[model samples]
Target: MPFDDFAHNPRTLLHIAGALRNRGVSPLELFRRVGVPPSALLDANGWVPRQLCFALSEEAGIVSGDRFLISKIGASFELVDFGPWGRTIAGARSVGEACAVAANNVELLHQGSALRFFTFARHAELRFEYHGRLGASPHQHLLGSMVFLRKIALLAKVPEAVSVRLSIPYSHGAECLEETCGPRLEFGCDYDSIVIDRSILDASIGDVGPNPIEVAETAEATGALLKRLLPYGRANLETVAAHLRVSARTVQRRLRDWGFSFEEILDDVRRTEATRHVISGENSAIEIAFLLGYSDPAHFTRAFRRWTGMPPRDYARAFRSNYS
Candidate 1:
């Protein structure tokens, strides 16, 4: 198989960077070995040459010196890291629904693989098939992804997962991989795929699955809602949820999925607004505190201390002294 005609997401390399760090491998050294720039490691917004992504991943695997690096990548992969594609799948009510959602959004990843959902008389399969395999890196990359999909199935209590497919020939070392891939695994297959019992398709994701609000876009929306509610001093969970037209409990759950607490969002809003008003010199500390919904100036002082390591006035003075 050829390597450079297509494009691939750079996030795989970003994940590899984390894996390398975990194994005491310097990302800088890996980047040098792979001949990719450090800045490009984080350039996940667009696609790069297919060859480069695989090279980085393969090099990272070598540098980490960890045989279980693919499993490590899967273990650390979070819903948020997948961005909108991940959130949409996680938001599905059922396994089939999630698979359907994933099926629809496969192109967004451009990860040198295609996903197709199939229904048989006995079961349904969410297949991750590579377009072509140039080397070991492609299978390694796809295996990490399959493990994540399998994790979702396990989380949803799917009792039967058929196995994982690998493009390489079978070997003794591959047996140890079952711990990460679960009990079933196949080797030397044309593609990598996951199979689960058809009965589990209709099963609900319940509280165990990731929430859609975990996506950064949704997190920003939550932040926007908090900004508007802060002046009311009731920027607490219930009030913000009311503004969002979602139940308070849902708001809490979704924010937790977004990796933040309501209090953290509220504090961030207060700190940001406080800094702005203070820097603008448009209001007294008391007025700024009131505007930030603090009942007392002392509370704002304490918060500013926690945020900037200095009281508001002292920081304001320092800000001016430095800028003036």
Candidate 2:
């Protein structure tokens, strides 16, 4: 799948482009290989596939220790299509209803993840769990979720009583952290979560329609379709087409209509897995390269440099710097 289909915003691509440039790779070459128009990066509001995003990361050699290329990419951009959902959600009758709408419609924004919403007497909590390897970093999902929550509050025009709880320790410094999540932000938590005051649930959403249940159903259907199309470990055009009882040609044509090729999709899946391996620190660069099907360490190095600007060693060093 094209990364354009999975990304919430195009600016993430720009960040990757910049990182690639830093590593001595030509951004235009990377964009061409990934099938992204060079100009699309400037339009921050545009969307791309999450898989493409991961492929770009792999191409950039971002897989590994401390630099958090994914978080930087995600954080650098604002959510596209967020405004429409925000408008619809803000009109909801209560915080509960708004949370429900957000929970329902999130798949419209990104499908490789799952969300759970819980309503308690005192607070409403939203938890995001990613079902696949994210292109940038594991924590990218958490940061992206936080950004989504922040956008939701902005769209709802609610008082900013919402706060985020994160599993990673704060590395961006106290001031930057406070600015990002509000003074209420808490890090080094067991999991990532967003909490909203229960009183917000009582607020009336005058413009919301009465058919949230129907909308929720439609959202679910959309989510299912997105999940079917996304690149995953089990995904191969032939395998998918076989299961769907369609010819591989038909599958290729269908994905072509969406501007992606099967090779691109498989490359994305491999790239995402490669990043995960790098972050876990369980494999050498050469091993990871081979695991992803590269013929040798040199080819992996060349490919990694193309994907991320830094060499694998330097990328890993930067990534670990934040953790240390």
Candidate 3:
């Protein structure tokens, strides 16, 4: 569980399932290979561990015999796949503007990775990078993203100006990439990027409009995300921000606008939930501590004292005696 805290939108897995179905592979196979329960995607906006997704991509390659399977998935990329994030991207006035939005908000759509849009001279690049711990096998994401990125350029009538750049070498599935992505797909490169002509950056995509979502709705959404992530994502400010897919400062500012602080909200949530568990008498103090995001039972004891003016054991014993 070294990297278990990293998570992504479950929509990605559903997208993979649809693509696998197209290739005559059973979607259930994804769960078997990754050993995660099918219920993981039950919530419409819940988060899934990012490593499970990466492992599924790798396994999907084996079961389907197409390492380029992810590229095939990206080939059909639609704005809807990104949910509200897609709607925001669709509102950008130009290709470059969209790229800028994508760079700033990649975490809203995907966590545990980075995306950047930059220009040098006559060419511009949208670069995607995974922290080195992921190793090279996960390059399918780079391939799939490049294919999808090319579509953005195509919207501007400049598909020819777009090419793929991946640090991975040409191998098993490179031929399939060459056929679909054209010869511009280069392997063993220095970066994973979507290269475009600088001037094409000015190509119009849509009319500029105000963002469709409001700050208050975002604050409520943050609280909802916190409720879901508290059990697995941890209750710390940084972890909550990561799950909200926004910066910690942004999370703090939003919570403040709602007249609440992150610590206040987290403490209240923990108290309500932990109080219920202690009263129910179903789980031990240590188990409740772990569920409350405490690494040590002592931490939970201190917190329980702060919440109820007694340690967890005393509170639980008192509750049981009243019922008995």
Per-residue lDDT tens digits for candidate 3, residues 203-243, read 88853334433333444565566567666746678876786
Instruction: Please give the lDDT score at residue 242 for candidate 1.
Output: 78
**For model 1, which pairs clash?**
none
Q: Per-residue lDDT for 37 in model 2?
A: 47
Worst 10 residues of 3 by lDDT: 207-216
Q: What's the TM-score of each model vs. the native?
A: 0.60, 0.45, 0.61
- Model 2, range 1-324, lDDT digits (tens) per residue? 433334655433434554454555565566667666443432334566666655655555443332444444444433332445555576677666777787887765555666678878788778776665565554544564575565444434565768788778877643455545566778788767777787676666454323322222222222233234443324455666666566778766544332334555455445445556777788998788766666677877776676667677877778889889
* Runs off by more than 4 Å, candidate 2: 1-51, 54-80, 133-136, 154-160, 172-175, 204-324
Candidate topping lDDT: 3
User: Where does candidate 3 stray beyond 4 Å?
Assistant: 206-324
Better of 1 and 2 by lDDT: 1
Rank order by TM-score, top first? 3, 1, 2
TM-score of 1: 0.60
Question: Candidates 1 and 3: which is better by lDDT?
Answer: 3
